[model samples]
Target: MARIISLEDVLKDQIKEINQLEMVTSFIQNKEELKDSLIQAQNDIEDLSIGVLGLKKDLEKMKEHNVSQRKLMALYQQLDDRIIHMTNNFPESLTQQLDRQEEKLNPIIKEKTPNSYKKPLAIVTNSDLTKCEPIITGDSIVKDCRKMLFKDPEDSYIIKELSDSEFSKIPKYMIGRQTLSTVNAFITTINQIMKFKYGILALGKVGARKKGELNLYLEFKKEESDLKAANQEGEIYFFNADDYERETNSKLDKTKLNLLTVLRHCKRIHEIRLGKNVKYRVITS
Candidate 1:
């Protein structure tokens, strides 16, 4: 009976050892599979990294191929700038030459002219503006200091020809009821603006309506010979082609030139001496 019991205990011990060994073998196999999966994931990440690098290189090459287009765009910008420089003050070609002289007409003979302009620098109360009351627009109205050194009253009449007040019976923009003081002030203002701002550049002489002549005319045509004519009172400036285009809403063309000619002859057209070369610049706001 003792022998039988001992043998049974030995058999139970053997069975327990076998079960433990089986568990250990299963755990080891699972760990090996996990290691294999980790290795495969690392390989996939490296392959994906290589593909991304290749795509980046292709994009860089595409950008490099656009060099000519980039250069062309730069060239277009420069050409546009040159166009503005040339046409900024004289955007439109001239219908009448600058040297073309008209027969001296008194007060521009209300017959051939239209009424007052929409935004005139100066206005006259009647047909014979030289003898009648004139109204002008501006901040300052007196040419107390810089008298435009004009050569002839006829050329000065060319400046005075800008006003044609007989168009409308009523004054459109003038205020103060045409009183004595108001009329004088308006005349002063027009003369000042023309002499200082709107007048053209002249070497030896600047043309403006002289004092007490009872004529109308400051025009953008100033005496270039003496820019300090007025002893520095008004604002004088130059504008780039871009700004001129923006203000006028057109490129430099024949139509645009007519508008510019009117402005230059009446207001201020741009002509400057740049390094010994005479060039036109946009000198108005």
Candidate 2:
């Protein structure tokens, strides 16, 4: 028995079949693209995560190496001192042998130790740096002065003066612009919290300041709050020797926060408020 199929019904049926086929084809194509994209994105994210993990591991290693280097430097100094003392008490040949050993150890020490931590250092400016030598030690830490240069044989570093064009090169962490009251409040809070000695102040291009001359300062305080509480009435000023002793004796507990990292964070804040690099004269005072 042949079922009678009208032309209208046949046309409708064909149209429906074609539409369904088109939709299914489109879906299949989209699904393939989506799957490929998902796979690619997953791979990219995994690679980025691995890179971040590697960077973290490297940073940890660097920090450990820095600590070890500091200790090694102390040991080296002690050994040198002992050799000098023995020169007065022991034979000349023994002193010679010690000197030879020290010479042999120099390259290994330089290679293993960070160049930033060296000695006979100074922050020589263009005028002062006629014969520039790297400031390898803790010399600049004492002065906190500008026109500063530090030399380390391990790192070939240069600091340009703050001119209109070169000012950008000055680390963001090095520059601060803050109100005087705000600055004072911060200082008070820090002193109260940590009971550090006097703070060190240098002229940065910007900072929270009351006057023009009050632009820059660094805080040097005792590490232990208990000790600070004990010496509440006493003035807090540290000389180079005092700082050295405090550091060596483990009394000066300070962490050297990476200045660059802080600066990047501040820049983000500035961008949020000011919408990026609005070159305003940072009134330091």
Candidate 3:
């Protein structure tokens, strides 16, 4: 009989095949683990991008809120200024009444002052206003002063009629309630007599039961005519169309004449001259 192979050699051959197969299976398992890790990383990156976009939107909303808050703050400042101005010299009850009255009437009135105005260098004393006379028509002053003060065309009228001697006799001029100043220094100088007394530029019916009229007036002094032409005191001023528009913040359809018509007839003036003592100037805020 032939010689048989040893059992140890057969056993060694089978073990070698088994070890090779195990190595191949291990390699396949490691590759699958690496692939899973890569997929998880990609998902994390996508989630991070979504979170960043959400944060950007929230930042924009915050910015818009800040802007609105700033605007409201500005409005509050304006209201504060008005309150301070109103409280300056008024009694508490009177102030409250005035506030209520203004609230009720401001809307009904047109958004304009008178179309014309005069600027006084000084308030004429009631005693002196009686002897003094405004030789030139307030209308003329309004036109010239408008050019000198505003350097532009305007729509306005002067309350020239009130400057007449008859009106000066009224108690308003004697009181210090409604005196006004001019926009031009030169005009003030020329009309310095008006500076010594109180004058009214506006008057209207007032009171519910008594129905007495309300008047506005101011005190002026002739000696103070040396002040700058553009310096204004109270509501009265030497104004042109431009000055009226600027001071009152109003618009006019036409240059309203007939300002002097409101005055009682007096000796017709032959000529009027604005002396060099007064100087007209442009008004600036």
State which candidate has the highest lDDT.
1
Q: Who wins the TM-score comparison?
A: 3
Question: What order do you get sorting by TM-score, best first?
Answer: 3, 2, 1
lDDT of 2 by residue, 167-235 (tens): 345455454443334323432332232221122222222321322324223222222233345442332
Clashes of each: 20, 25, 40
Whole-model lDDT, candidate 3? 0.42
Comparing candidate 1 with candidate 3, which one achieves the higher TM-score?
A: 3
Of the two candidates 1 and 3, the one with more favorable lDDT, higher being better, is: 1
Candidate 3 wrong stretches, greater than 4 Å: 1-28, 89-285
TM-score of each: 0.21, 0.22, 0.24
Single out the weakest 10-residue window by summed lDDT for candidate 1.
Answer: 112-121
Ranking by lDDT: 1, 2, 3
Q: lDDT tens string, model 3, 1-285?
A: 998989999899889988988887787868788788889999999999999999999999999999999999999999999899877856889878988999988777544343234343433345534443334675552222323333221112222222434545545433233322321222332233222112232221222112221322211222224333435453323323333333346642322222211121222111111343322222211
Model 1 agreement with the true structure over 1-285: per-residue lDDT tens digits: 565568889999999999999988887879888788889999999999999999999988888878878998999999999989877767243625432434333335543112121222332233333343233448644332112222222224222222434222323333213343433343343344344333322211213222221222222233332343534334344322333444446555654444344435434445554344332333322
Least well predicted 10-residue stretch by lDDT in candidate 2: 276-285
